[model samples]
Each structure stands twice: as C-alpha cells, then as structure tokens.
Target: MRLSNKRKAPLYNFINTALIMFLVMGILAFFAEEMRFQLLGMEAYLFIAVPAMLIIIFYLNGRQIFEYDSDGEALHFRNRNIVPFMSTPLSDEFPKYKFVKFETFTFLFFKRLYITINSKSGNTILKYEISYLTWKELNDLKFSLNKVIKNNKEKVNDE
Candidate 1:
C-alpha cells in the first residue's frame, strides 16, 4: 500500500498565508498611535501577544507532508515540513524483516510516529511528525505497520 498527503499542500499554504498577514497587521497596529489607543479600547500588548501566540500555536501544530509505502518486501516512510528551507526531511527505508515495532505519542497539539528497528549495535528509533495526517490516514498507516510487524514475528518463528 502507498499513502501520501500531497493533496493537502494548498490548505497548508492558505493557513501560512493567513498567519503571515495577521502578523503583519499586528505589527502595523503596534506602530499606529490611534489604532493602538483608540480602537476597541484594547491594550497594545494584545496586538503583540496575540500574534506571538498564534505563531507559537502554528509551530506546535506543524503542517507537514507524510508518505508511507509498504511494498516489495520493504517499507518506506518520509516526512517533511511544509515550510521550505526551514528543516530537513526525515526518511527511512528498511527491510520488512528488520521492522521491530511501531508506536505513537502525542505532545501538546502534535502527534508523532516512532518506528523501531533492530540493528547490530542496538534498537534504533526514528521519529516523524504526523500531526497533519487525518484520522483515516493514521488508521491506515497503523494497520500497515502492524501487519508488517506481525509478518516479521511469524517469519522468525518459522525459521
């Protein structure tokens, strides 16, 4: 099976554009004397605080593109942020027999996928940010990984 989120790029781009516009407006309000003191009788701190908080929230709820492929005796997983040039992509491909286990964890607003593989030295864990994947996609991913793990275990017992 192959799964990817290339279709969601436009949605993420829209969110990024809105956030940037908001930040620009916030900075403008900070400099405008009348808007800062007169409009809605709001505090100047609000303009600064709100935009900063929005940025933090956006960062925590990372917008990323995720791909998972399990075919031809191997599994491939790739994760990259939507923001270009900000961070490097995470990718891993290992044989089905090497797949040890898979787990997931949620921190704050984002979800993570952890894949563990047995190596000569020790167990190595790879992490990927999966916050942007929908529930259906997540279920598909979990099901695929679990199937591989089960097959690996059975193969070991047979041998």
Candidate 2:
C-alpha cells in the first residue's frame, strides 16, 4: 500500500553546534580587537569551520521523508531531493513490532519514531530516526507493515 504525509520543516541536527560556534566566535572576535593574533586566528578558523561543517552535515543527512510504501516484499522509504532508502525481504515471522523514541541529549538530536522487528532467531531489525514524519505518515506506515505481517501469519497458519 502507498502511504504519505505532508512535509514539515526540516529538523536541524546542528543547532547546538551552530550556536556554540557562534558564541565562541563572538568571544574571540571581541578579544581579537586587542590585537591578540592567536585569538584572531582561532576566531577566523571557527568562523569558517563551523558553518562549513554544518552545511556538510546538513547535506549528508538532512533530507526528510514524508512517505513510504511496503508491498509485502520490500519497504520503500522516500525523501525530498535525495535517493530513497529501501529494505527488502520484509520479515514476517517476528515476535513483535516495537515502536520506540530515542533522544540524544549530548547532541540535542531527537528521533520521534523507530521500529524494531523482533525475530525468532534472536535478532532484531531496526529503522531509526523517523522524526521528520508526521503522525499520519507514521500511522500509515505502521498499518501497512502490520497488514503485511498479518498476511504472512495467515499464510503460515493455512500451511
């Protein structure tokens, strides 16, 4: 089935980093007015390095998806302006499907949703950092996945 949601604002993972960099640069710039070459050099480096790093990180991971599809065989996750990430052989013999929310206080990054598929082989399949999704999208994805699992279960029961 096809599932989608309205796109929301991009979630920035480098906010704290940007803020700290700005603060440090401001301080260094203030001190550099006294002709401290070392501090001036540090400020220059910080001014360039901080935004450059932020841009690189944003480009690498900031693309967020508003829709996904699972057609009983594979999972297709799509995002804006980037290649979609897909998973195949969507397992059905899982003991349970768990939804989890994880946050990293150190980096000020939060993930609003994660799906963990527990398998009989004592292994788990995990999909992480789905915070960009709206509630509707999340629900649709859950529903589609459960439907697949249910069908698989029924097929096994018939056999």
Candidate 3:
C-alpha cells in the first residue's frame, strides 16, 4: 500500500519554530532596549525583528512531506523543507496487536489536534495543527495502521 500527501510543512514545525524564535527575540529585544537606554537616548524594539524573520522563513520555505509505503516497510517524514526528520520502519508486528483505543483531543484553545494511538505495546501520540490536512487523510492512515494490528492478533490466536 502506498499513501502520500503533498501538503505544506507540518504544523508542528511551524509552532516549534515560532516558539523558539519568540523566546530568542524576546531576549534580544530586551538587551537591545537596555543597551540603547544606557548608551544612547533612542528607544528601539529589536526583539520584533527576530520573530518577524522567523515568520517569513516559516511561511516561505516551510514544507512537509508525509509518505507511507507498506510494501517497502517504511514511513518517511520531512519538515521545514530540510532533511528528512523521521524514517521509521514499518514493523510487521503492527498487524498482530489489537488496537485498544484511539482518541483525538483539541488543545491550545482548539487550535491543534492531538491524536493518541493505543495498542498492545502501549500508546503513541502525535499532534498536528496544520490546516492543509483533511479528515480523509487522517482516517486513511489509521485504517492502514490497523491492518498491522489485526494481523498480529490473528497470528496469536492461531497459535
């Protein structure tokens, strides 16, 4: 099975970048203001510059790539239009374990979606807030993953 999405970068990358940029800029602005007050009589807001740059970089160059190929036994992910962020092996054991439950919750004032996957091995959770993804894409991913769990359970039962 081959599943792919040609969407923009993942929302997580944007959020992470924004947050880090905010902090860095905040500090820089504080120092800039302090220096100006001490050395010169002019007041300046240098902190805003860093965050502005971050926003531009994120919007212009940010890209996300999601691909899952069951036949090839790989799941590939790329973020920020840079090197691949994740390349996980598609374990054959996935199909044998039953899906205990799966849930999605809204966070950050409902600006993001947090998906929690629970199986026999435990729980794996991922959060996304990008507007580019559709419900169908999310559902299809879940369905494909469930196949692995089902197969694992069947094998156990047969044994």
Model 3, 64-139: lDDT tens digits are 4445454543333222232345333222223223333344443332223333445556777554332234568657
Give the CA lDDT, 0 to 100, for residue 118 in model 1. Answer: 86
Write the number of the candidate with greater lDDT, choosing between 1 and 3.
1
TM-score of 2: 0.41
lDDT of 1 by residue, 1-159 (tens): 999997998888788788888888987887684544565454765776798788778767753799999989888998887887867888889888989998999776689998999888999998888898888999999998888988888998999
lDDT of each: 0.84, 0.49, 0.49
Candidate 1 residue spans exceeding 4 A from truth:
34-42
Model 3's alpha-carbon lDDT is 0.49
Alpha carbon lDDT at 153, candidate 1:
83
RMSD, model 1, all Cα superposed?
A: 2.0
After aligning candidate 1 to the native by TM-score, how far in Å is the CA of 91 from where it should be?
Answer: 1.5
TM-score (all chains, Cα) for each model: 0.90, 0.41, 0.39
How much is 17 displaced in model 2, in angstroms?
15
Model 3: how far residue 99 lies from native, Å: 11
